[model samples]
Target: MTDFKYETVLSEIVEDGVRCITLNRPDRLNAMNRGLIDDVARAFEDANADQKTRAIIFTGAGKAFCAGDDRREHVHPTCEEEARDLVLAIQRSTYAIVLNHKPVVGAINGWAVGGGFEWAINCDFPIWGESARGFFPEVSLNLFVTGGVSSLLPVLVGLNTAREMLFLGERYDATQLQAMGVAWKTVSDPELMGTARSTARRLADLPPLSVRAMKRVLNATALTDLRRAMDLETEATIAGFMDPETTRRLKDF
Candidate 1:
């Protein structure tokens, strides 16, 4: 893989040909600040272009996989222009991951809240740690989810279950997510990295062209509405950020 440097993310080649990109913000539980968001997007884009990178394993450096957006860094947008810009910037990470050529495996270690949870689902294969937890707190926070979740989620779990998850913003354990078909596997926290490495190794051993073709075909078939969902989410999220109530709520938090 190419030698890439990032402030909020760590990238390295591991497991023969797997690119391990770690979200690095231990003090903030790997929150998605603008720097982190941009770093993630760049890392995936670099991996996509690097012929040596056969697969990717995404994880967090600290306890939590990602705690959504960093309240301090992601200030509430004061105007429509700011909100639209922020929404587009935030969505870049999703586009990078979903559109990448190589397969991605999420090593979800801990909390995957809000946008963090959306990213986990965006992975081609998501392997959760036993203690991992996921939830959508966007509705409660006067915010909205992105990452094409509006379309991807309902397919993983039925519309009714998806409604419960999104509308209620309830937390679900790793086992629960696996049962819901959102997680490909749930392993003990100690085994999370090992499992991810093994999974990536298997993917790396496959014929690159065949694997890429299959991924493209699958995405084309199942995610026909992904772009539409992302557009709708961007609009909704920008509106949410522009609301004065959202600013007030964010301040209180």
Candidate 2:
């Protein structure tokens, strides 16, 4: 972490062993492009390996936690390899959080749309702000959810609820996600960072080895399906990316 100077994100370790990683592209509402995606993967990898950091708190720097992928920079791949690589980069970034030995928490300051929702949900759990909005505009935009959400989301919110979010490309506020039993807590915007850091510190105070073992066991059992679903999603996304209909729809949107 010391050698790398991150451009799309900022990282600092707090006194209580909680490292805060704030997505830094405020002008773009902290949207995920290649740089942000790579930085996230690298940051989480470093945080997990850092003995001084016991838990991580992820948030965004400006009005939004993340506005999702930067669509203006989004690419439509011409070949299968390019398509798969693009999707895989995205997949790896999300998986990096899961791969961490320490617990990860998201503090959603505002918008968490599309891939942003994936990032939020990928954390062990998320503490959201009251003003935060979550949604998947992917279907309309001719894209698919990049993470293993195809498997994980249905488990949290039920199949029908997942369908509403995925198929219909619907929006859900923080309160609604909290009610659905997805979000950990909903705090006022001003309390977002404080609440997130407090929670991370609490988690960091647990027996370190036990916490790591617990996470490993939980992931092995709970994420078995997620691994398979992510693979399928990647393959399908690449094929879909080249579809004429999808291309036309993407351009229209």
Candidate 3:
């Protein structure tokens, strides 16, 4: 197979038609900075276009799957315009994952918070390690999750559980998430990637058109229509990020 044109993050095609995409900024705990955000979206888009790539497995390079938006990069210009642009970028990056047709799996090795949690939610399945943790702490930051979590969380763990997590900003360990039906499975930290890869390979072995059609059907149930849902999500995300309270909390972070 041809090599992937990767930069900012690392990506490679493994056996059994699995594409492994790793968030490479271990030094930052795999934080989603602006560059990594763009790269991740591009990686998924590329994988979607590649005929040989049947499934995608996403994971991080270090102690954490992703710590969320890098605090350093998020705290920018003390003005509204810059904040608007920042939010829009994040929304677009997130939309790429949600709209991708191929099966996507998240190998959560450690913490997945804020945007990181949203990223994981975008995946068709989330397989977590024993040490993995997931949380939506955006409420504490005066921000709401705009990364399709509002729609996805209820479906994963029920509306009551979703409200508790999003409204209270609580965090849950892999075991808890598994019990809540949010996680597909949990394995040892050392075996996280192996489990994810195996899952991806199994998925890739299935009939491609059937898999794609199933994904479309699943997504169809989530909204009045795909395009309408996307537009609503985009607008809500941009507005949430631009909220005065959210801006204040972001600056403080």
Candidate 4:
């Protein structure tokens, strides 16, 4: 992990063979920009390949875990090719987390909106702070979600609940999400990182080979269409970007 460097992410080995990766754009509430998204993808890939890093604790730096895209400073693709590249780069972060060999523990400290909520779902264990909230704002923004959530959400909370979450874009508190089986546990803000670190420690202590095997087997059996769903979502999102209505909506937002 020491050999790797990132512009919008901070990686360091925590105790008990666990690596803690923090999203570093606190000024922007860690919103997903090109640099942050690329850094997250590379960071997870590096952690997956590092044998010494047994588990990963993923969290944000400030009040919000991630405010989704940096709407104010967001990049706009001028053409379909640029839109495809942007969408692919956004999807790559989710791939790194979901397909990583090592387990990822999410410390959802605050608002996990849109893409941030999708990333939280991508974690093997998502722990939320009591005050944290989550919701899908993609539909409202004239965009679609990435992160294979198109396949995973319905399975986690059922088809009806998933539709409500995605279509209505209402916020759900930490306790509510835990009850829906989307969050593993909810703790106070002060305990958020500690709980996540403890969870990572437990994972680190497990038999690595067995854990990895279980993850691969479970994903293979349960999420067989994950890649397809992601691909579809990417294409849909590209269409959203190319639509003039989306540009108008973004401007109004």
Candidate 5:
């Protein structure tokens, strides 16, 4: 199969039937902007369509995995409509990752916060480096998690742990994340990508049809219907963004 095409924020390659999509915004800690989100969605779509690609791995380019949304772009007018739009965009990005039929593993090397944390949570498996840290610090900025965090977090780490993470807005190291059931395993920083690639290759070696079917079955319980979940998440996200309080908080940040 042909390799996927990507731009500044994304890099794609197919190796051993495993497609690797790397977030390439190292200068900004690989923070998600409009370009990154667009590229990521396209990359996932492309990977899913490639018959040779049985699994996918997502990682970052710099010292950090993703620091969430670009703060520079987020500083804007405290308008309800604009906030709603921002939320919808975020939901779309998250849904893209979750709905992709191929198995996805998030190789978190450094820090993943806010929307980044939400993105990692949506992946089928989360493999972290010893230095990796994850958290939902949106509350610290007076903003709430919008990218299916309400649904995914509770399922991944339970209601009480989710509440603590959301409420405290503190970072959790890889060890803590593993304890909370959010991280599948922690590897040394140098082995992070290699470990993830090996894991993806192993998945790729499985019967593709059966693997896909299994994923569908597993997702059915967490996500009743992929399309329906996406729709609801999109609506809730937009509403949250359009809220007066949220608008004000976003503007202040």
Candidate 6:
């Protein structure tokens, strides 16, 4: 929690040792630009390594938790090689949270669409606003899943449910996800940050060693080699991006 400044993310460590990082592109609904994605991954890595950071909270500055990648960022990669590298890097952004030692909480204030949905679900626990909704629009957009979601999501909500999410690209509200056990809690829009902060504080107050150990054990059992899955997903995603129809579709969107 040293003095870190990022162009698209804001980080703050509370007195209680909870580090809150806000995705700062409100006008774009916190869309994942290349800069924002890298900033997010770096922020989580730094917070995890910091001894003073007991727990981390991730939220957006405005209405949406994230709206997935900016169209420009997606269109920027000039060739298959560059697109592959870019997709892998984007996939790693969400892994920065799941692979971290300490607990990560997502404060989902609004839309978490496409890659945004991947980001929220990868958090150790997510507290979402009543207005918050998430969806995997990848299939429709000719994109593949990232964030190790294909492997991790099946473990959370079962194979069929995960398929329904990915294949059908359905939008899920806070209540539906809470019912499916994907969301830890869902509160009113105004109460979202407060509830997440309170939960993060409770976690930060716990024994740091025990908390870290618990998260490690959980990852060992349930989140093993998440990076590998992300790599595979990245390959598929880049292929999709390179498809001419997908390029046309993205441009139209």
What's each prediction's TM-score? 0.97, 0.95, 0.90, 0.97, 0.88, 0.94
Per-residue C-alpha lDDT of model 2 across residues 56-111, encoded as one tens digit per residue: 89999889989987878876788888888788988887788875678998998889
In candidate 2, position 89 carries an lDDT of 86
- Listed per candidate, the RMSD to the true structure in angstroms reads 1.2, 1.6, 2.2, 1.1, 2.5, 1.6
What shift in Å separates residue 151 of candidate 6 from its native position after superposition? 1.2
Q: Per-residue lDDT of 146-207 in model 1, one digit per residue for the tens?
A: 99999999988989999999999999999999999999999999999999999999999999
Tell me the lDDT of model 4 at 241.
94
Scored by lDDT, model 4 comes in at: 0.91
User: Model 3, range 1-253, lDDT digits (tens) per residue?
Assistant: 4366666677788886898888898989888888987788888888888898889898999899999878876655355576567666766755666776889988988889888888887888889999999888777876657666777788788989999999898889999989998888989998988899889999999999999988878887764354554456666656666677877777786
lDDT of each: 0.90, 0.85, 0.80, 0.91, 0.78, 0.85
Please give the TM-score that candidate 6 achieves against the real structure.
0.94
Residue 208 in model 2: lDDT: 96
Error of 3 at 184 (Å): 0.9
Per-model tally of clashing residue pairs: 0, 0, 0, 0, 0, 0
> Between prediction 4 and prediction 6, which has the larger lDDT?
4
Candidate 6 — which pairs collide? none
Model 1 ranges with Cα > 4 A deviation: none
The runs of at least 3 residues in candidate 6 whose Cα sits more than 4 Å from the true structure, single-residue gaps closed, are none
Worst 10 residues of 3 by lDDT: 222-231
Error of 6 at 120 (Å): 0.2
For model 2, the superposed segments whose C-alpha errors exceed 4 Å read: 1-4
State the lDDT of candidate 4 residue by residue for 6-121, as single tens digits: 99999889775899989999999999898998899999999899888899999999889999889877888989999999989888988899976789999998899888898899
